[model samples]
Target: MSWHLFVVFFASTFFISATPGPNMLLAFQYGLNYGVKRTLWTLAGLSLGLFILLLSTLLGLDVISRQSPWLLTVIKTIGALYLIYLGISSWRDTNNSSLMSDASAMSAEVSAELTPNPDRSAKPLPRSLSSAAVKSVPNDWILFRTGMWVSLSNPKAILFFAAFFPKFINFSAPLWPQYIMLTVGLFLSETIWQLIYTIGGKKLAGWLDVGERLAWLNRGCGVIFILIAAALIVDVISTL
Candidate 1:
């Protein structure tokens, strides 16, 4: 592929990746709950899942769709159901503790430690005890798996890749090298936007630290997930 073509492809993908989707929503939600350092695992998982979809499309998803269309429908149905499960899980997760509360607790603990206390014999509460109200953080593996499954829960992405990539591909050129270049370009775009969403979520969490705003934000994400799942189901029914 020529430089001009690659540039165009990159531009198109950058805009496409910027669109808010399930993957971005996950990154945002995880970033708000877990912070940026841990959210890296989720981002990695998202990349892997997206890579698999792209690879499957390039390898033979088009042929599979033509040969076994029902299989695609089955995949979509399962994906939609999984999304509904995630949506309900998010909706039901009504943890009252916000990151701001945790920070405030820690700050208070530090202040107490710094203050001259007459009761030297009385020890300060342990860090865990002080922040006991905060929910336990999920292990890294759980975050990664959540990201992967969320990404994979939209099999329409495979169909999207199958349709979208061909417009940028050159049939006359050596295919694998072009694929590699395109993949790298697309990933670069995705990574940038994912980071943007994560950081944006973190900042939003900070602002919404008052009362139940953060909790509502999470429920809002849950509602979006269900909406996307419903749209997917509708599309599947239409195809039938």
Candidate 2:
């Protein structure tokens, strides 16, 4: 692609990425709860999801998506339902967790101390409510998977990339080199932007009162997620 086209694409993508979508929101949410360092895993998962979307688009999923609108709607509905479930769960967790056992309390205490990493056997986690099964925050891999799921679940992302990426393509030229260049640039820039949001969230966490838990933030993110889910539903309905 020409420099002018690259600039336009980069700027557009950067700004669009800056917008608080599910992926960004998840990064922000996790950043607050898990800190910037751990959030890197989540961001990595999001980037992988984006890479898959771009690759799928390049491989002509865009054509299929365009041909089958219902597929997109179904994907969107499924994504929305997932987010709605998360929102409700997050909200309820924030409230109910107020009375939760001490095991669930802490920044990353319970999760780190009790729950073994997925690589480990499940023999450790207590059945009822010991330090282990206290509704603790997830570990790194779980957060990463959460990011992947959130990104991949959003059908809007597939459609958006499908529609948006083609505009800057130089069909007359060799595709592979351009693909490599654009994907690398796009991925790196997006990663940087996501890091900023994650770091910003971490900084915000620093400002919270020492005693303040992540419950309020969880509740807030839950509401935002529900709104996003609602918006997706509204969009789907509008299409019909």
Candidate 3:
């Protein structure tokens, strides 16, 4: 691809990745609760999922979906149900002790501040309890599967990649290299952004002490996800 085409493609992909979506939000939650390292794994799984989606679409899976109405319907139902289940879990887990584990860390910091002679020169603070909670959750195979399921189950994401990936290609030349660059760029940029959010959220652990604020944030994201799932389900039913 020419530099101009590459730049435009990169810019567009970056912008799309930067938009706060379910994956990014999940990354943030993972980062805030787990820690950068584990979240990195989640991010890896997520990137892999995206790449698989791209490859599948490129391999004419979209054509199959178009030709098989029932298949698409099945995907839509599964995707919507999965999203709703995730949303409800998040909402219910708002008060999960794991989420509140950072409370002790914050208390320790406050206690140290109150002491007359706290150590002036200590090593950099370790990750917060919130991050520890994330780490404590057994990510194992389930996280990988969840990432893959969420990415591949959504027909909308497939439609998105199908519509978007081709626009960056130059039909005049061989397409493989362009595909490689686009897929790599998309995956890297998206992964990096999620990492940034995950790491950034870890730094905001102090704010976790404010239970009200944290609850509000959780509820907000949870509600948005629920609404998105509802809309997707409605669309599915209407299509049926």
Against the true structure, what is every candidate's RMSD? 11.8, 10.3, 11.9
Q: Give the TM-score of candidate 3.
A: 0.54
After superposition, candidate 1 runs with Cα above 4 Å error: 61-134, 202-240
Candidate topping TM-score: 1
Q: Write the per-residue lDDT of candidate 3 for residues 101-161, one digit (tens) a residue.
A: 4433532332344333433442333465533342234334544554555455556677665
Q: lDDT per model, in order?
A: 0.67, 0.61, 0.58
State the lDDT of candidate 2 residue by residue for 13-130, as single tens digits. 6644554456666666556555577778888888888888878766663343457757766766766777677678767764332212221233234245434564442223224324
- The residue-by-residue lDDT of candidate 1 on 108-215, one tens digit each, is 343244333433343343353334422445566765766777678788787556545654555546777888988999999999989987878556546666677656
Q: List the residue pairs that clash in candidate 1.
A: none
**Runs in model 3 lying further than 4 Å from the true structure:** 61-127, 130-136, 202-240
Residue 58 lDDT, candidate 3, scale 0-100: 59
List the candidate numbers ranked by lDDT, top first: 1, 2, 3
RMSD of 3: 11.9
